[model samples]
Target: MQPSDSQLTGVPQTVIIDPNTGLPQNVVIIQQPSSGPKIIGILIIIFGAITVLSEVISLGNTISFGGLFLVLSAVNVIVGVGYIAGGYMIQA
Candidate 1:
């Protein structure tokens, strides 16, 4: 009996031998690199900061005009903080 020529190619076979057990083990590991999530997190943080700053400016204008909208400004600030926290959490 003779082994097929394909068996002599030395290519990494799907069934790998386990050094400890001397038996075939079916396990495959692959590594991939991605940047989408990091970019999204950074963008979220930047937009959040911009939203917070714009809200602050609007709040100042409202105050100067004697318009009562303090609650709205506070809500905006809170939302901005939440966005920043979410972005940082995603990055981590």
Candidate 2:
């Protein structure tokens, strides 16, 4: 005989069937929600700003390390800005 209309199709045979109705019971599907990326970007920017400020402050103490600090500070700022831009793009 052909399958009845009430019979479940494309459903796993292992599913628990209702005793009275002869159909799957208590089927639940769970899904995770998407989260945005913005806080990380802000943190990166803040860190970069702090590094640059510390480098500037150190410039007054020693001349030998000033060049290295300047380079490091610039790199930090650039990376931080890139992260912020990336976060904005992801949000959009």
lDDT of each: 0.80, 0.63
lDDT of candidate 1 over 7-85, digit per residue (tens) = 7655775876898677787556586857778888898999899989998778767676664467677788899999998
Per-residue lDDT over 1-92 for candidate 2, one digit per residue giving the tens place of the 0 to 100 score: 78899987685657778887776876466877445345665565566566656656766554565777667766765775675566566555
- How many pairs of residues in model 1 come into backbone collision? 0
Q: What does the lDDT read for residue 8 in candidate 2?
A: 73
Which candidate ranks first by lDDT, i.e. highest? Answer: 1
TM-score of 2: 0.37
TM-score of each: 0.64, 0.37
Best by TM-score: 1
- Pairs that clash in candidate 2: none
Q: Report the error of model 1 at residue 57, Å.
A: 1.8
